[model samples]
Target chain A: MRPAAPMSIKPQADAVQLVLAALIAFALALPFATLKPNRIVPGQPLFLLDGPPFWARALVILALIALATVTWLGCRPSLRIVVTATALMAVILALGSTAGHLPPSNAYARLSPAAGFWLLTGALGLGIADGFARLKPSPLAGLMAVLAAVLILAGLFSSGWLSGISILREYQGRSDVFWREAVQHVWLAIGSLAAAIIIGIPFGLLCHRRPRLKAVALNGLNIVQTIPSIALFGILIGPMAWIGSHVPGASALGIAGIGAAPAFVALLLYSLLPMVANTLSGLAAVPRDLIEAARGMGMTDRQRLWKVEVPLALPVLLAAVRIVLVQNIGLATVAALIGGGGFGVFVFQGLGQNAADLILLGALPTVGLAFVAAVIMDALIAWSAPRKGRGSIA
Target chain B: MTFASRAIPRLIGLCLLLGLFLQPQLFEPVFRPLANTSAPSIYAQAELWSLALSHVVLALGATLGALILAVSAAVVVTRSWGASFLPLSRSIANIGQTFPPVAVLALAVPALGFGDRPTFVALLIYGLLPIFETTLTGLTTLPAPVMEAARGSGMTEWQCLRTVELPLALPLIVAGFRLSLVIGLSTAAIGSTVAARTLGEVIIAGLQSNNLAFIVQGGLAVAGLAVLAHDALTALEIWARRRTRLAV
Candidate 1:
């Protein structure tokens, strides 16, 4: 057998890349770390990190670095690496808890003010840089774009009245609170998105191949889309209740009246429309000649799909994922009503408590997450898509 | 069939009215008598109309607020350095959408509490993403050549945007608006939870009183509102597209 080529990751050369990756990974965790539930109310100030002891903060930072390093290193590793990392993390958290290092506040302090700021800035800067790099333009376009961007960034940064620093600090701290609530909310949203993609893509494929099924699926999804989230939740309640009562193992799984089960099912149903529509549109957009060419090349149906059609259609498919993602983010909020707990806890809690500030706490992060995800997903979709002029959907 | 299509929604509206008014036997069980004594369900009374109007006020205001924030943000992003922040903005928007509307209600309840303000706030946040995204998409898709041509003729960026981009993007923007409005309308039902009068009040009342008719009536009203908005928007879009096509 031929020997494999030498593997190389130049240490100093990789430092910049590693730092960039580390910064982003850390930023993603910032929001998670800051997410917690305590002294939360609207109007009255609720600190994201309400003045924890100094040592606690140090420990938190250490834990964050440890987590970040482990996660980063873990990515390139084999099975043994993962097993070791998991064991280490478990031990650290266990030991850390004994030494009072496990609490969120300690985690925050450990993520030193300087480090936190650096990581946050670096991640955002890199994200913007990456965005610009992808949108390569003519000199004129580049110059004009840069000038315009600088002006806007300056205004935003210097919008002294906006008090962005405090807002950002709070934002970081709230990320901790969000992290707690988002665990389930994120799961439900992702679960729904996955289910949508699975169900919708196949249905779209089936519809394309079968005329009768197409109408049924199309009309069914359309009707589903039209039903408001609350009403959809209401509709699912009855069926879910029946399932809980009659199904063999539903009760064991805690399929109660209002909770994750009904919420998950409802969100999955809600997600079907866009996923199906986008998949159908993407498949249809594939050129007829291409498929025929594949056939002429003596490729079987399966091979044609795997080789030609899907490659051409992937960008659109990813765009559908984007749509479902945005849709899921919005609809997942409603899951709060049925007790499928998530960031909605903050919103409902804020509302129930009559706290606008608290509402802002919940609402702002949600809006931020949605916008960021859409942009990132759009960028990914654009990158993955077959090179061409712009398509109908972004 | 075309005429029927046009007439059916109106006819449904009429039948719904008649079903409640003349056919007492049909709706009585569902719409319990308003007073314990023997009156018709309050949902069929003048009180319900007033309640619905109040709900409309809240919904419209919230939707308007959402529109202002979404459109302004979208325009700024597309027009200026806002582009740099687009990803972050999109992410924020996602979070907004993901943050549950009910939670907004609950969260708002504490600050605004038991009134229209909280409902308005919730609806506004809930309605933002579609309009924001659609507006952003519409603005960005302004044919670059058209903008260049206009710019070559010495039109300023603002002029180019106002004349070429805005006009072209209107249809898509309106589509987003329509979506937001429908969503806002349906979600406005949550307003009933805090005591603002709306069609939702009918449903909630029915729930409290165990009157199915009230629930049906409320639900139908909500559905009717959605269809009306959808049709109106569809018609507007057709007109706008035709006009744009003719212009081109």
Candidate 2:
């Protein structure tokens, strides 16, 4: 990490420059926001200069110029990062303030961040992630920073600073059902993951114990995994409905054709492959001599497995848990397509109505949840790893 | 062994192609009994064959697109002169992989309006990482002695790379392509939600109308494509390994 000598600073064009250039170009050429007369109607694109308040407009122009200058100069990496982050924050604050002050011509008139804003955020997000990786090199610190930022954003919005943004308005409109849907999404994702672990571990163990069964089981699971989530959920409904209507105690057990049951079942089936495959690999990864040592200590096969094998294979198993959790969180969103209530309810609703903000409402939390799940599981997987050079599929 | 290797995929591919094209007619009778509503048993808004074709196009087109982008990027990054780009390229690929495919697909709607175009964009993004990562591994892990001999024979860097590294990496690259293609196929069904004319349309239509027959037909056809694609590529993988002189 030597500081570049001014004379020796060969053009080290980094992602920061690429990102800032993209942001500046987008701000100049594209619309920063859209003003819709109604939620479902296609909105008029509002360019960077079109947002209200001359002072805010001037401030945004200054920020863009500053970003372009830094990018052109190929300055210090840390300074570039600082400027890039500041630019995003300032633009956001400006956007919020502009939206808040807009005098609506109609009751349903709304302003939402458009493609230009997305590009600005996206490019800067990438730049920040890359810059931090090179500059700080502590993923844990980065993760904590992400949490604090999300909390601050939540606080800001709750204080109604950005309530004028259409997406936030959509959230406010459905704030009651929003929590319910969020709960359903989390329940389906985690519940399915828990079921997979409970059922898959023993199944994986059986496959590990016997080669013939392993081939058949793994192949079947592979086939199952290949089915699209919606199709799988669709296919489950008929048989499940039959069971619910005809079989004793099925209704009592909450088995239904098109509700959370089918979605949960499909998610569990989808989860089994990674769970089983990882378990097989993890069990195989355990040292043979250690198991023998346990046997020599007069341990039964069960005792040896419990005392020796599982602990050694734990990290790779946790890797499986991580994969399943992240995957289930995503697939559960599609569950709403099948009458299984989740955030996907908003996504499909948005699509059906052609309401862009509603789609964002559904999509944002799903990605965020999957992201947080991956981060937490990664931390857990790292913690569970033995102090050896063992590799797990994180 | 060779006969079976060729025949297995050919058989599955043949059956799947037929099933994919003729799914509506094939399922009409079964669905007539299954679909209790007064609505038509078969999906007829658009021909099932055309829907299936668009489905295949979305997935395969993306896979091929990802292949070209990732393979070239990986090749460049693995070159001695291009080594400095490896870490950055890997980070880019990693970021693509962390975003779930569905989210990627959804996000595309905001930037690019819905249709096959957005789905294609999402699929291309989703499929890049596996091929890039695998290609990186394949090129970087070339046997040193083989590279040495190629160099000693007075081959130019370009000539040696053309003849040696890529051929050696083909099997791994094919394996990566297989993974990417399988994922794309499975995911293509969801594209119908975005007006992409995929088989997912049948499932969606059925769900809306409360028709079970349409769902089964669509689900079975989509699943059939997945299995056939996997087997076909596995067959290709076997041939690649054999040609590359790896034990198959």
Candidate 3:
């Protein structure tokens, strides 16, 4: 053995590690809270050092150290994921406990986490998920990790571990109203989607049959989509109010200028473009050979449409449903401006009150709803895909 | 026949642009029936042209920002070294879409302290996903043979991307840009709520006072912009496709 062949090692730097390091550095340096006496009052800067207990602080430091160590060692992918996940959990617990323990200096005084805290938490959470994703390409794993974290967080919240947080206080005060608004929000979204499908599918089929109609219908819906949510809401009010007052039975059935009526109509109109366009596209995508074969088998136009076209089109159509549902859930937040009760009520109230926590209280749930809708729709599309097309469709 | 086919959409687009400028005079007669009602006439209150110009500017700015960010992101993810970042980039784009623009405004206001900044942020976020996704689709779905041929000719990665791939993908990318621009136009209207100068101010005021004319003015201006922009972009896409076909 001639003096052991010289070994050459190439130093490698992971971009992910570099990003995590920068994020940790930023979190350490920035002020974690803008301390305030109450929701309405302006907050003064409160650094991390001025807040969180020593152990909580230590946990944050430890997490950051662990992340750095993993980066330095260039650990195995699985080990990196586990370390990142643990660090994330530690950061979450530390932040939560810190927020929960912020002493209520007075009955009115409230301590709220500021921009830095939000940025740090979001970065840590995202980093951990990205790490998990790097370990395995599946989105489901990252999603499961997120679900686990959320469950743990929720458990903490419910068990009174996080009761002292300002946002929780906001929730505690309006828990009933929050639930009511959430229900109302979901109801409005579902109602508009149902209405859109009922009206849109027939219109789409009509457009599909008549090439001339397709252009006009599509252009009209596109124009409708171009109208801003607020403008659409505003436009609906005059006509709706006029109809409500002049039409005898309209008011009795809740068709008013304001409240849910205009909101529902606007949302329905918004949903139409996606529903109709998708229907048209999905139908168009059905293979010409398949349709011809169906016809050759003595299938009538109706049978071909029902049995062949729709079955083939189901995936795309379901995709459209997902898009419309998610879009409506988001758009419905603006409905609150017109007395259409929903999460927007909390949003506007928060805006008016100058309370960031209240806004988060409202906004987070809306995001949650949209996420749920997306996931469900994705699952539905996956389930509905033809067995032969599963590999191709995704 | 080709000229005629192309001319029709151009004509429609030009007509819409002309109509947008002439809306006050043209719509005055049409809105006369409502003038007698409690709501004020649309042209009576403010300069529709200025509001329309502001709306266009906001949308254009947001679209430019979104296009730059999205195209760069798309390009990065398609590269060999950055390929692993694709899912991450996609999720980031999805998150941008997942948060409502209104919520973005609310959250941004706290950090940026309300005005055009938050509005810009919201519009940029809202517009990003469409362009990014479409660009990705355009880049990723290039004909394998064409790509192989380009590489077979000893073209550098950047050169291939710049000369062949980009040209091929231009139409679809432009389509995505058009979608983002239209969305930005619509969404920028909500910027009014955050103290951003937009046509939405007209609409919001209308909502507050129950003024149909104001709503019509704002809505018409925004919608007209959208339709005209859409037509122009569609024409561009068609032209790009034709050019690519001719090149091939």
Interface RMSD of each: 7.1, 1.9, 1.8
| Per-model DockQ against the true two-chain complex | 0.17, 0.58, 0.54
For candidate 2, the lDDT comes to 0.82
lDDT of 1: 0.62
Error of 1 at B61 (Å): 3.4
Q: Report the lDDT tens digits of candidate 3 across residue range A259-304.
A: 9999999999999999999999999988888888899999999998
- State the lDDT of candidate 3 residue by residue for B67-181, as single tens digits: 9999998999899888867766776676567677778777777777667888888788778888998899999999999999999999999999999998999988999999889
The numbered model that scores best in DockQ is 2
Q: What is the TM-score of each predicted model, taking all chains together?
A: 0.61, 0.90, 0.89
10 residues in a row with least lDDT, candidate 2 chain B: B19-28
**Residues A352-390 of candidate 2: C-alpha lDDT, one tens digit per residue:** 777778989999989888877877776677677775564
In model 1, what is the error at residue B205, expressed in angstroms?
6.0
Report candidate 3's interface RMSD in Å: 1.8
Q: Model 2: runs farther than 4 Å from truth?
A: A1-23, A49-83, A135-139, A388-394, B1-13, B16-20, B23-29, B37-39, B80-85, B246-248
CAPRI verdict (incorrect, acceptable, medium, high) for model 2: medium
Tell me the lDDT of model 3 at A157.
74
